[model samples]
Target chain A: MKIRPINHKKPSKIRELTYELKVEQVMCDDVITLSPDDTMNDVLRILRDNKIRGILVLDKDRLVGVVSIEDLISCLVDKGKLNEKIENRMTKDIVTVYSDESIVQVVNKFEDNGYGRFPVIDRDTKKLVGILTKGDIIDGLLEKLEIEYRQEEIHRYRASHIFEDVISDNSTLIMQYHIKGGDFKKAGEQTSKLRKNLLRLGIMPETIRRVAIASFEAEMNTVIYTPEGELIAKIQPDKITINTIDSGPGIPNIKQAMRQGYSTAPDWVRELGFGAGMGLPNIKNCSDEMKIKSKVGKGTDLQFIIYRRENET
Target chain B: MKLSRIIQILDAKILCNVQGRLDSDIPMICGSDLMSDVLAFIKSGALLLTGLTTIQVVYTAENAGVNVVCFVRGKKPSKETVDLANEKKITLLTTNMSMFESCGKLYNNGLIGGSDYEN
Candidate 1:
C-alpha cells in the first residue's frame, strides 16, 4: 500500500522493474536441513534432487553447521572418506541470515560473512526456511541488466564491428582471421572483442558464439606461429564475417595443418601450457562457412562466416 | 569478521572505497598461488589471496567476479595495476605475510573455502 524510497535502483518501466526485483517479496520461506548423521549418499541426493547448492546441518532443532558441494568433492577426492560417516566432516560453523533481512542486506551478508550461500532461517522459529545462492543474486542482477538493455539497444565502438559498418543493406559480408606466429601475447584479444561487440549489437547468441570460436582460433594461430599478422572482420545483416591474415612463415603443408592431430607449437610454449595445435581446425569446426588460403612464402588467411537466420536477419 | 575487521587483522591498507563502507564479513575464501587454478576453481564472490600480481590477476578477478584481492607477503603492485584495480572497483588489499601464513590465519579464524553451487 506504500511505496518506500530505496537506494539508487535504476529507473525503468514497471515491467522492467519487476524483472529485476527477483528477491522474494514475502521473504524466502523454504530451506533444507541436514542432520550430521545424513550420509554422503543422502546429502548428494539432496543436492541433486533439490538442485540446491548447500544444506543446513542441524543438531536436533538447533542449527549447528552446513555442508556444500566443494566439501563433498574434497571428501570424495582427497580423503577417500565419503563412504565414512558424514557427521565427522560436516562443517560446524554455518553462515546464515534471518528471513526478515532486506535482499540487499542478504546480498551484503554473502561476502561480509565470506560464504557464498546461506541458510535463511525464521528468527523466531530459528527454522531453516530457504537457501540463498550467489547464482541467485547474479540471476537477479542479470535479469535487471538484460531488461535495462532491451529497453534501449545501443551500439558502441569496437574493432570487430568494422564489418558491421561496411556491409550493405542488400548484401552480406563475411571474413576469417589468422594470427601470425610469435604473437602469443595478443591471442584471443580479437575474438574476445568480437564476442563483446556482437553482444552489444544485440546479435543472436548463437551467431555470436560462432564468430567467437572462429576468431579465437585465428588469433591464437597468429600468436603461436605467425611472424606478423592482423585479424580481419566483416559484418552484414545476413552474416558476420571474420578473417585472420598472417604474413608469418606460412604453413608448409595445408593438409598436415588441417589434420586434427597435427601440431607444431614449441615445447616451451606448451610448458607454460597452451597451444594444442588444433587452433585452425577448431576455428574451422565452429564456423558456418570456412576456407583456408595459404602459400609458403606469403603466409595464411582464414575466412569464416556465420549466417544470421532469415527472420532475425 | 567484518571486512573492516580484516583491515584490522592484517593491518592492511585498503585501496578504493575504504570509507568504512566495504563488506568484510566473507562467508568463504579460496587461497591459491597459481592464478589460473584459483580462477578455474573459485566461485563468483570469494575473497582471493595470492602471491602473484600480473595483469591477469585483475583479469581473472574481474571475470570470476571475485570481490576482494589480498596480495600477500609484502607484494606491492605496479601503479598500472592499482589503476586497473581502481577502474574495476574491486577491493585490493595488501598484507605482509607469506601465502601459507596468511591463509592459515584466515582459516584458523574461521573462513570457509570452496563454494556450494552443488547442481
Candidate 2:
C-alpha cells in the first residue's frame, strides 16, 4: 500500500465562506431567558420544555448571568435548592458574542473558552438578542456550503450545455438520477451510467471499479428502503464524489445497519437477493471517505468521496 | 487459478460469454449467499460462489470487486441478473454441485479462501 501525505496546508473553502457571515444571520433570535430572581424550578421547566442546555438570565432588560443545566443539576444534588433564586447559583462570568461580530470571531471565542453556547447581544443596547451554539454554527456553515455548491452546479450545467467541447479538461462533471422504491428492474442503472461517464473521462480502471461498486450499493440502498431518492455524482480533477439523499423512513440505527449481515429488509426484498445488510459496508469499503446523516422519520443523506490515483491521466 | 481452469474443475455452465481478458488470473475464491458477508470478506479479482440468484448478487459481486460469480446447486439467475452481469462485465456460471461440495472441490483444486483464516 502506498502512503499518501496529508495535505494540511490547504484551507477549506467552507471555513473561508463562513468567516464572512455575521452572527446575526445564524443565531437563534428567539431567545429563551430567565429573570435573575426566577426560582430554580423555572429554569428546570424551561430547559426541559424547550430542550435547551442553558437559559440566558436577564435583569431589567440587561443581560446578566446564564444558567445551564449543569448548574441546576449540581445545585439540585449538592443543596437540593429547587426554590432558590437563580442569581445566587447562576454563572456570572459569561462570555458573549455581539450580533454584528463575524462568525469567525464567535468561533475563536468558542475555541478559546470551550463554551458550548454564547449569548448574542446587540452592540448598542447590550440586550440579549439571541443565543448561538456550536450546533448552530455548524448548521450555518453547512447551509452556506450547500448554497455555494448548488450555485456552482448551476453554472457548470449552463456552461456544459451552452459551450459543449469548450468545457476544459479540468472542469468537473456532475450527473444526477432519481431512484424509486421497489424498483428492482432498474436497479444498478445509475451506477452503470456513472461507470460509462467515468470511463469516458479516462479514469483508471481500478478507480472506476471502486466508484461503480460504491455508487451501485448506494443506489440499491435507496431503491430497497426509501420511497424515493436522488443520487448525485460529481467528477472532479482529483476525486469523485457521490451523494445519495432519500425521503422518508430513514435508518434508525446507522451503527447496526453498518454491521455485517445485519438486515432489516423484509423477507420479500431478501428473496430478491438484496437486504443482506452489507450495502453500507460495501460503500464504505470502496470509498476513501463516507458520511451518513439520517433522521428516524425524516430522511437520510449519504456522501462519499473517492480520490483519483496518481498514475491516472 | 484461471477462470477457464475453474470452469473445467467445477464442470460449470457458462451462462454468458466469458469474453475479454480471459487469461486474467483469479487470486482466491469466496462462497456465500449472504451479500453482507461477501462484501465484508471479498478481495479484488476473487471468484464468488453462491446459490443466490438475484440481481443483488451480481451487484454485490461487482461492488465487492469480485470479477466472477458461479451459482451452486443448479441455481439459475433471472434474466435481469444475467443482463446486469453482462452490463458490468462480470463472468457468470452455474453448477449442479452443492455449496459444500463445490467449495471442497475448489479447495482441493488449490483455490484458497480469500480471507485470512489463520488469524
Candidate 3:
C-alpha cells in the first residue's frame, strides 16, 4: 500500500505524461447489449427485470443506440409511448470505443461527453460487439487507485527519508495563491499537486486527506464566486494548516454560505452540474477546525487545520 | 425506480464498497453535469445522472461512498473509467437525455424528492 513519490521532474511536463496510460489496460469487457429493433416492452422488461440502467443499441449488427431505465420510465409515465419505436426513443449520436485508445482518452471521453456505456466495436466491421459499461470504467478507476496509491506510498517513503535529514522542528510553509475565479477545469490542480507533494513528504495519510479536502474546497470556492484567491499551506510538526485568501465579491452572509442550499453560482456552473453550494460545508465537515472572514466588497478567506495523528509521532 | 430495483433491473454489477444497500428506495434522482455537487449533496443510493466521463467521477463516487453513476446525454466512459467503477463495486450506467429533460422525466416518473416507497 506504499505510494511511490511521483518523480517531481515529471510534473512540469504534464503534457509528456499524456500518452502514458493506455485504454485496453483499464476497460472491462463484461457489458450488456440490446439491439435497436428491440421494443420498449423488451427494453423495459430488461430494465425492470434486470434492475439495470442502460442497454446498448445495435442495428444491422452495428452499434447504434443506447437505452436506459430513465428513458423507459419516461415512456411509461407519458402513457402514449407504450409501443413507440425504441430507435426513436433511444438516445442516438452515441459515444463508442475501439478498444485501442488510451485510458486517459477514455477518461476524457467519460468526462467531456457524459458517457458511461460504450459499445466496443471492430474498427472495420463496426459490429455491435462487446459492451463497455460504467462498470467497466469503474474497474479502470479502481486499477488506477492501486497504481496511484502505490506511487503515493513510494513518494511518502521518499519524503520520510527527506524529512529525516531535515530534522524539522517546525512544519514547512508552502507559498500558495488563491485559485482564479471561474476556472473549473483547474479547480483541483492546486490540491492535487499539493497532495502529491505531501505524499512524497511522507506526511500521515489522515493528515494528507484533511489537507486535501481543505485545499480542494478553497480551490473550488475560488472558482465558484470569489473571482480570485490564494490557498497557503503550512506543514507544522504538530498540525497542518491551510489558509485561503481572496479579493473578489465577498460573502455578505457567512452563515448562509455555510448552509448547503445557499449558492451564488451562475447558470453555466449549474449546467456543468456542480455548485450545489456544498463546497464550504464539505470543507468545514472535513477540517478539525475552521475559520472564515469576509467583507462584502472585499472577498473572503477560509482557514482550516487538522492535527497529526498521535501514534505517528 | 428504486436503487435496489435499479440494480436488480439491470442485473447490475455492484462495483463499489457499500454498507446499506437496502435501507432506502431511491426515488427522485437528479442527474447533473458535474461531479462535485453529486459528491456533496446526493445521499447514498441516490442514483447519479451526469454527462461527465472521467476516472475522477468514479473517484468522486468512491470517495463519497456512492454506489451507482449513470452518464446521460450518451456520455460513454472509456475502459479506464469503467474499470475503476468495477473495482470500486460502483454501478456505472449510460443514458441519452440532456440534463434538464432527464431530470424532468425521472422526477415525473416518481423519482420524486424525498418520496420513498416500499416498492
Best lDDT goes to which candidate? 2
User: Number of backbone collisions per candidate, in order?
Assistant: 35, 0, 74
Model 1 interface CAPRI class: incorrect
Error of 1 at A105 (Å): 13
Cα lDDT listed for each candidate: 0.64, 0.81, 0.65
TM-score of chain A of each: 0.47, 0.49, 0.50
Tens digits of per-residue lDDT for model 3 on A26-57? 54455566676668888877777777678877
Best by TM-score: 2
Minimal lDDT window, size 10, model 3 chain A: A1-10
Candidate 1 lDDT, tens digit per residue, A192-255?
5556556666677656655665565566567767776877777666777777777877878888
State TM-scores per candidate: 0.41, 0.57, 0.48
lDDT of 2 at A223: 88
Residue pairs with backbone atoms closer than 3 Å in model 2 (clashes): none
DockQ of 2: 0.16
Model 3, runs deviating above 4 Å: A1-154, A173-178, A203-207, B1-37, B41-69, B77-119
How far in Å is the alpha carbon of A144 misplaced in model 1? 16
lDDT of 3: 0.65
Model 2 CAPRI rating? incorrect
